[model samples]
Target: MEQHHPSLRSEALALLRSGVTNREVAEKLGVPRGTVGWWLHEDRKARGVVVAERPHNCPRCLSLPINRPAYAYLLGLYLGDGHIVAKGKQNHLSIYCCDGWPGLIDDAEDTMRKVLTGTNTGRRAKIGCTEVKSYSKHWTCLFPQHGPGMKHQRRIELSDWQQEIADGFPWELVRGLIHSDGCRFTNWTTRMVGGKRKRYEYPRYYFTNKSDDIRKIFTDTLDRLGVEWRTLARGSDPYNISIARRPSVALMDAHIGPKY
Candidate 1:
């Protein structure tokens, strides 16, 4: 936004030449993207440097995962509880997971790193959650399922690539979605049999989302993994979709335990 030092200006151009996107260069240099763009063009022109038409980063460099476990996990997080904020010409993705389980946060962060490859990742603390965030216009490219308004208010479908990832690593995807917007906890019930009170406890999982499409993705992944889950309410509103079945609980526990 303000004047930059001569060295910093040259550094910005160098970053561009090295395959960094203009938006990223500006952010890294702590300046506006327009400034970086104009300065780079002027300097290149003055030096008789023939610049490529596209100021955007290289296609190969921007190529993130299309069908990988990390990408699938990130997708599930985005579908379940992530939001993208478009700030001017840049887009930032933020996914918040409850602090009750730090493993969820770790998984989300690891997924981001594995997918984004070389981008800067950011995090923040919320009242009851931890946030994993990153800024990149390419995020939109990675997640084509994004749309205007809330997920429940809009319909978004998975692309063919996403379907492939879902089919291949359904567990990671299912775990991410459930971790962000669902819960794995103990369920206890008491009954009077033959005038005696008895109590039984079992582990159950619940995945909740307002979007039918998102809910379907979660359940579909479970189905692929042979994990049983049920829609708690047929036509009425229950809290979330439930997976209280014993076999399902054991299967999930083997993979996704309480994220402590």
Candidate 2:
């Protein structure tokens, strides 16, 4: 290991303690990124800093203005396929997105960051999906719907403030839900036209979830937006909401069409 000047080490530590990334500090100080990381590690070890969570700018805790639209969208995603784990010094919120749709994955991570400013995000690859995660102790504070069991097995309801945000940005909420757990596809049938068979196609949207409360929340937002939907049963259980009406599909296409 090459030795650096004492003054350079002090400057690097100062920049790092002020929230600069290891790469940024290294470039600024003309040091290797690995050396910057090693310095930070030693400094924390010597100071007994067991946890190095960055400073959190939780809107709820700081009484700061929230990006309500982003929050609403993130809330919908949470209800569809997100979870928060806050146990024994481990705290984070994770939203799973299919790997094929890189755009959705990026959107999910971006929205999480927007909702909880100053939080750090990471990605974990599953068999066929990517988990976009953000770390912060206050995730539970924002998502009271999190509980001890699966979402379907527990009651899920938004707080009054969350409700207000959802009401104000219903389309974003619907978009988020669809982006996470819903899809838009075309259905086709054959019709005789001028003695020739012609295939006719129409587009419809479906939002599926096992949690009845979550489905109701999605439908309630649709009701407010005047987008008609019907519940459908999957294997003898109601698990899908279908939006096929022409006018409603048009409305959906205008605001929250197929996931990109």
Candidate 3:
């Protein structure tokens, strides 16, 4: 067996005692599975937690009570461009994002793994789209918005736990939505100032989604953060939201700058 750090052993044991399985504890703590198994076996000998006594299902796969920034971000991504499908005892969660964006795929994978403690991988699905997929037994519980049809056709609402997370860290939710389906860039204009023409460029954030409910969730979170936004054509079309002012832009910069 490879020599391992004592901290890794401690982390693995902690996670295992907190209900994570040996496999999940190893991957989560960046330790070898065999090491985790040995550690847990030793712990079981000490505390009497045995394989036969273990739940047939993995506790980490069950309903997660984490309401941190990562969970809020994943919730936003799901609302924007993710899909959760029930597949045999697990819910497969996949979020499609722009492949050209900087560090988006990497960030999504990291955030999901941190929040759900699950194995995740990203793949190129199309010309400009990448999908980050992970399996968890509690995805449906986390994102109750998942349904038979499209998000717009169905009501997109947050669960009570999701509401708690969004209310606390609305910025993370905004970041995930913007990273997945929105963009921020400089908008320049030229006008007469002091009887002379001057050019100025300002940063603005734009979020466009086909689902009104999703857009409302984004805007509502922004509202909670006191971020200003304008709706161009309400109920007319998607991509109708824009935040083009200074203070709002500055706030967003502090919270949800370019993911990289």
Candidate that would win on TM-score: 2
**lDDT (10s digit) by residue, model 3, range 1-260:** 88888887887888888988888887777778888888987988998755543232232355435648888788778887889879756567888877776488877778777776645455657777778887765667667787898887988888776788798888788888988778888999999999999998999998888787888898888888899999876665655789998999998888788655
The lDDT, on a scale of 0 to 1, for candidate 1 is 0.79
lDDT of 2 by residue, 1-260 (tens): 78999999999999989999999999998999999888998999999889655577888888999999899889888998899988855589999999888999999999998999888899999999999999888898899888898999988888899999998999999999999889999988999999999999999999999998999999999999999999989789999999999999999999998877
Candidate 1 lowest-lDDT run of ten: 52-61
Clashing pairs in 3: none
What local lDDT score does residue 191 receive in model 2, on the 0 to 100 scale? 100
Clashing pairs for model 1 are none
Task: Name the lDDT value of residue 33 in candidate 3.
Answer: 87
Q: Supply candidate 3's per-residue lDDT for 244.
A: 92
Better structure of 1 and 3 per TM-score: 1
Candidate 1 similarity to native, TM-score: 0.75
TM-score of each: 0.75, 0.80, 0.71
Cα lDDT, all candidates: 0.79, 0.91, 0.79
Better of 2 and 3 by lDDT: 2
Displacement of the residue 155 alpha carbon in candidate 3, Å: 0.6
